[model samples]
Target: MVKLIGDLIKDVIEPGFCLGCNACVAACPMQCIKKEENEIPVLKTGCINCGICYGQCPQVVDPKTLQKAIFGDNPTDELLGTYTQALAVEAKDAIMKAHGQDGGAVTALLSSLLDDGYIDGAVVVGTGEAPWQPVARVATTTGELIECAGSKYTRTPLFIGLRDAVNLYYRKRVAIVGTPCNIVASWRMQFSEPTNRHLGETIRLRVGLFCGGVFRYKEFLKDIIERQLRAPLAEVAKFDMKDGRFVIYLRHKPKRELALSAVKRYIDLPCKICSDFTAEFADISVGSAGSPHGRSTVLIRTPTGAEAFDVAKKFRKFSAVELEKVKPGIEGVRLEAKAKKGAAAKELEIMRRQKKPLPVWLQERPPEPPKETIESLKSISRV
Candidate 1:
């Protein structure tokens, strides 16, 4: 009998229909799947059937349910404010100061988890030369967490690490720091075969960050090109999310102000479809949205998250930023969200289609792309 990979992850049979896209076949880690004509993926031997393809498939047999399942329930009236709240967590290690984008709140949280023996390792999205590099970084020390700091704007698809994370647990525990989609991967990973024993036992924490939308890494690079003079990607310094704008820094300082037309073309697909800017699924959603430099805007969800923040508060790792500076941006986000509800998605569609790709950076690893000053990071870093 022909078996479907979806059966392993869920009770429902996986969709047999195909968009004839080779995404799943190309993405399969086990090399167990093959693509036929019209992008129909055929299962093969050694098919551990990890079900990675099920998530990557563009054609959803079930759109409404699928979209809701991934996005979670829509906004309620009470769910105002950013998805994250401003708070601190005890990350005693000094690594928090160096790694990450700015104030290093995420580094601190991961360190606390590692030091407290709460988790053996964590799954996070580390920036790579290209995109979609969502692998797990086993953090045995605080320094490791710092090394993999910052909010990687590209779609890291971090959920892919669940299987590996379970392997590393060795019956211990692990934490996950990711975006909403990454968290969605976690939720899906729960049932996706070989049932993760560690998931129930040791996958202890989930650290999330306030997100505007999910975008494609390719689009981001393309945007860089539109801004630069079609330079090759030399280095990526920053993906600044301040003032309601996403500022991309490239290595070639000469061609700074890229054409706005190019940027529109390179924006990702999901962010265009999605309206949720804040992640409600995360344990603690953190950001620099409203917080001043050297600070982070944190939102605590679970009790553990609140407790973690409480403990971290004692260290005085960050100062507070005035809410006013961030207010305009947040307001802009709300307006954007509102626009997403009806006609705006269409407007974006037109804008996207008409937009042209900009230029690429000249070199790789450009000078640590400019980061907001420590004082600025501190402003958003704490409660």
Candidate 2:
């Protein structure tokens, strides 16, 4: 029997392995799946059992299979994943730089793409009705992209914006910025059978953010920030993870910080099992780990990504420091990735010993492809 959302819930969601990337909700033809704040998706009335939701779910899909399909037989890096080059970059736009989490490279890159007419819209996270809460939306202009700047340490279903971009707005070419899990779900939607490939095809670029983990909104914002720290959410200027602490910048008060260990309990459960810290499947990955306080570390992972970066650079959207010029350089990024992967591996091992359910990708290895097939797959361009 073909698996359905119920099967997906039993295998992934119940196991606390669901990434909550919203691929299933976006790809559902009947629009039966709905995602609520800090919850796994719930199915409504439709019961076609088309299996599209199951196929597009990042946890249900085998990541290795998707990697082989996307990156082909390229020699894999133990830490940082497949990439062409690394750089330290900072956005030139003063407003964007000021409002952004670090260097504002992501905001600048998306603006550059929009200015160049490369993409009709971009799926990005913006502040929602509640303070510090993230809501996904489609940005069609540079101003809109800038408004959506900064990092939300909480997870949002980005694919919902993707669906609105393609289906509601009828945007032909689009870009998406998301975490590693979100990138994985994008690949699953692109290559998985019984999925809406058109939704994947509309995505011209995938800009991934380096993620340590995400926090539950209620616990992190309400319990930790409001009650514990005695800071009102509305007064918060920004949220950041710096030097092993969760830092909160408030508009009218001195910034407050708590050691990450203090808030570890609030981290989403699924993040513990995730190993991709640099978004290995993304076109490009950007983060603050390897660069100076005001700069971002960027990894150009694909030819398409390289092309987009080049366009942005040519337009003077951001200033770049060559990997060698940056102190610690890619090594810094590699160390962070290694630490995250190590922690995940240990968690997986612990879960295994406890006889808990695990995602198929973590439990089973897919057979290697033939040499000829690998070569052919590599020749197929994602662009």
Candidate 3:
């Protein structure tokens, strides 16, 4: 029998494997799944049990299957995944360079795509009503995109923003900016059984950010930043993870730094099991891992990513240094990726030894029925 939302909740969410990407909420045809702020999706009444929600979940879907669907080959690179080229990029836009988290390459690239009419809008994470809280929204212009720049250490359900961009805003073509989990969720929506192919068709570009992990907002911002450090969240200018420390910049005040070890316990539970460090399935993967202080490491993984990057470069939106020229180069990114994968593997082994429930992706199971077979069965059942 096929698994449903209840199974998803018991196996993934209860086991603390849900990535909170909101793909299931977006792909639900009956609108039964509701995505709560910083919470796993809740299934309301009227679920048809079509299995789309279970299939679209990033935690449940196998990464290797999605990789083959998106990249057309089994990736041999263990650390960084398959990619065409790597570069260190610094945004040429002064505002983006100054305000963006690192090099602002993602902001610059999105701006270029919007200005050139390559994409109708982009799904991005912006500041919410509460200070430093991440909220996902659609950016249709460069100004809006710029406002959405910078990193939020907290997780948001970005795929909901993609749904609104296409379904509500009527954007025909959209770009999605997210972390590795979000990218996996996108691919799951695109290729999973009982697919929401129409929704996936609007996603023209996938730009993934490098992530170490995300923290719970209340824990990290409230307990650590506000209470412990005595720094007001409203006065905060930016957040950065650098040199093994979590750095906080405040307005008109001296910045404060906390060793990553100090806040390690605040990291969200779902992040511990994640292995993808560089968003291997994205069109283009970007992060600060392999670049200098004011630059981002860009990995063009597919032709779509290469084309977009080339167009942005031809317009001089950013300056780039080939991977070979950058100090430490891909080695820096490789080391981090390797470490993350190693840690996740160790954790999974421990969980297995404990007989803990694992996500479907990590479980040994027979292949799911194809979409055609599922449709035929549905037809027969209705008869």
Candidate 4:
């Protein structure tokens, strides 16, 4: 049963453990893992066996909920305080603010690292006339970094920078900021290529954002058009994860509004299979929802992340608040996530327990990524 999580972690680090959560299907390097009824995780058995899922699972998957698991009862160190939206401020009160959600704490953190010469560059996302464009960018300055703000909840591949970082790793280090899936991909790449001496050694930091959820690129956009506004899915240029709600402003004759409930119903087949809400492989993971403005909520997962952030704090880039205690409400979200996954997994084990006929939903593949970008929609975010 993999009773000990440490055992699971070790097995996963080497040969691997499934924990029965099916994130592997969506993020598979080989496009494996299929969904059965209700969209649960099912190892295709035909899987090419790429290990993306092993590294991405919440570093600790308690299976009970989607909430972050605090294994130790250690006092909550106020690495940074919680914020809503009011606390935001600029970088130098810098140029990045123009691009970020609010004042741009994220930009500030990345910019600080760059300005101090700590990192040679920042791996970030920027928008293009299409979805693929927002997937990658190597930001080296405040202006270049901020241009890629707003919530981009689609799945992106961070390994896109793997080659570039390796090429430039000699003189400077690189810090990567991304969602859970992207972070795990990069982390694995580093372990595999660590001694590259140039790129692997140069990639120094991983910053993960607390994830509310990630949707399939096409399905998410489709929901906004069909269910919510009953309008054309004009374009979804910019998005944000704020206040426990996924806020996406749509563009229609007048503008259109979409709610999370309708979107949740349409989550992609891949998301339904895997269940890590926080990017567990990152060095430091950030989240909003309960975190207010001006203040950023940070989870210091690695000693390196803690040290790097401490260095930034010394520069007065921003101030931080230490939670006397983490609110149960905040933890509740994760718990719910974990529970949802558990119920689904138990069902998988039950039906498959017999090695008999298991529920199955198969599809003929060979589909291309959607050519869905409408040039006209790009204007919505700019205006």
Candidate 5:
């Protein structure tokens, strides 16, 4: 339906609705698009109006249609999307647990999928050329998974590697792990009208990471880490956001902390309007929220996700318990998801009051944002 570049810009881009998922950049048949600031894509030339970008954009695709296409029903929940089960899990292997952000469930699960023939490869985010930056990669081996293990609190145009996974590597079945927007785009690419049926066929599993908002890594790294701390990038061993502060760990030096309120200024614009926190459409969604420091909360959304978990268990890849056993537990996740929904609803209201027409995705509110959500744009402006 979106036949022209102008339509996409007006409907999604201009409204600050583009999620920077790179679906448009990747789907461009002419390769006329490239990412700017390693975030949103910019057209390299004049309009092509090929419609491929629109066909793949999650912003304009209706979730009801996507739900019916994926699950054959419109069953919905006010929070946490459509899911069958929720649990807390951690990798069984010591090595996996050591390298991953939390329990290393993603790395462990994807490794099992790769070994057990469930998927030939996985689209993952790894360290970019610069410190604290994220780069999309396709990992087919355990070593590759380890390389991408830790969290990068930033957005990576992960699906951009989908083409290489299919056309170049010829992987018939592949898994993909991404934020909510990335998962949405993957599903829409499969079922949307005039879809890339081939790519959809190759997507064996969709894994979503729980996200609140992703900060601009370049700004956080350059402005805060380099300018404020004057720390050498190589000496910085890890960066994390926990307990309302951005924690920077160095190889031997003392750690540094920055309040989340201050860091909120660098959050991507599209993240403010997001409507899915737990990646409701993903086969399995995993996040550290509502779990122990060394564990991940896993939301099994579909039969496929359950099947993958079973296979991972069979391989002795992870150990999981009922979510009820955890301290924060399912209630913690629910409250966080609800808070994000509320914030997004407020954002939409402000947009409407300002006479700004919203795109289809943002016009509706009330679902999805990861943990530690920003409360008010007004508060952020003061920052």
Candidate 6:
């Protein structure tokens, strides 16, 4: 059966595979989609079945097929995806590093991109009305970038920022930094023929953050933060999941933490279904997952990503160390990635027995692409 945008609501959304990334909402030309307080997208009224929303959705197409479309037939590592280089990096700017969740490489890279005119602005998630509440914003200057530097453990519908950055703000070239699911959405939107060409043009760069999982803010904040941690939301100076604990740094109190496994019960269903640990589809992926306290593991996955790194290096934004020389080396990342994939595969099987459709990412890997599709991919290659 041919799939349409409406099909996404039943096949993926209702089944709990939707990442709430807002890619579908941005793709809808009718402006019929809206996300409520619960963080799920709902179609308002007009039902054209135009398919752009589904085409732009990451959950609809197989990740393996998308990878082939982007990376050609050259085999990629099972864990790291296709990459030109891997390194441990840290921002040279001390202030950025201080504000950063880890190494500040993402903010430093965006700073260089803006200064070099590679991008007009960047889409970032920052503290919102409530502490740790993620608000998507366009960072047009270094100060704005710095304000959006750190991580928010909660899932933010980050791709919605693209709509504002392009339609409302009228930015010509934009960079976006987001988690693994967001990267999947961006890469699909960038290449999907049904997506608005102008909207696709504004996306100049994709920076992905490695993610373990995202906690539901209402649950994690009210229950865990206020009730268990005995701290108010406004007092949180910094919050992150490190090692095996959920660490919270308050402005006036001693550091507090809880077992990471204890908090897993608060993770949303979509995150539980997600398998991309290192953002396998992103041009460049950065995370503290397998790095020392002061460094970030940077995976340069495409030629464009490598070029961006070279430019950032020329500007002396950050320094890179050999991946093998780092504390939690490439092997650490590989093991985690494999474990996540295995867990997802097992969950997919259980869902299958329950008469639910498996998400695109969990489908069997695709074989070689047809000659025509390979040619099509080459023509569409932006990097």
Question: What Cα-based lDDT does every candidate model obtain?
Answer: 0.48, 0.83, 0.83, 0.48, 0.77, 0.80
Between candidates 4 and 6, the lDDT winner: 6
Q: Model 2 residue 353 lDDT?
A: 97
Model 4 alpha-carbon drift over 4 Å, by segment: 1-98, 131-133, 168-172, 192-199, 222-237, 242-244, 250-257, 293-295, 324-383
lDDT tens digits, residue span 1-383, model 6 = 33576678877788777767788887788988887764678989986878788767877666667676778655378787888788998999999999988899999999988899888989998877777788789999989999998888886888778888998889998888988878778866766656656666677778888887888778788777888868998888888876668888999989888887787778777777677889887879998877888898999987778877887777788888988888778888888787778777777678889977676545545244356754654554454
Of the two candidates 1 and 5, the one with more favorable lDDT, higher being better, is: 5
Tens-digit lDDT string for candidate 4 (1-383): 11222332343422222222233333444545554432234555454334544433433333222112111122232212112112222344645544566446677887778777777788776655654233556777777877776566665544444444444433367887876655544433333211122333456787777665565555555445545556443454446655435555554344444466556655543344444454555667666533445344566665566666767765676555542233433454345446445644564465467553322221122122122321211121111
Candidate 1 segments exceeding 4 Å error: 1-44, 48-98, 128-136, 169-171, 191-201, 218-232, 250-262, 314-383
**What's the TM-score of each model vs. the native?**
0.63, 0.94, 0.92, 0.60, 0.88, 0.92
Best by TM-score: 2
Q: Please provide, for model 2 over 1-383, each residue's C-alpha lDDT reduced to its tens digit, 9 standing for 90 to 100.
A: 45777888888877777766788898999988888657468888976989999878878655556566666555368798888888999999899899788999999888988889888899999978988788889999888988889999887878999999998999988889999989888876765566788898788889999998998778778887899878999999899985578998999989988898778778887888788889888889999988988899999988889988888777788999887688778888889899888988888899899998888666666354346644543453353
How many backbone clashes can be found in candidate 4?
Answer: 26
1-383 in candidate 5: lDDT tens per residue? 34455667777877677767788777677778778874777878855667777778888755544454455455556787777888899998899998888889999999988889989999998877777678888899999999999877777787777877887889988999988888888866764444565776678888998888787666767776788779777788777765467888888899988887777767776676676778777889998878989999999877788887888778888888989898798888888788777877777788789988776654555233222221221121111
Off by over 4 Å in 2: 74-76, 364-383
lDDT of 1 at 196: 31
Which of the two, 1 or 5, has more TM-score?
A: 5
Report model 3's TM-score to 2 decimal places.
0.92
Clashing pairs in 2: none
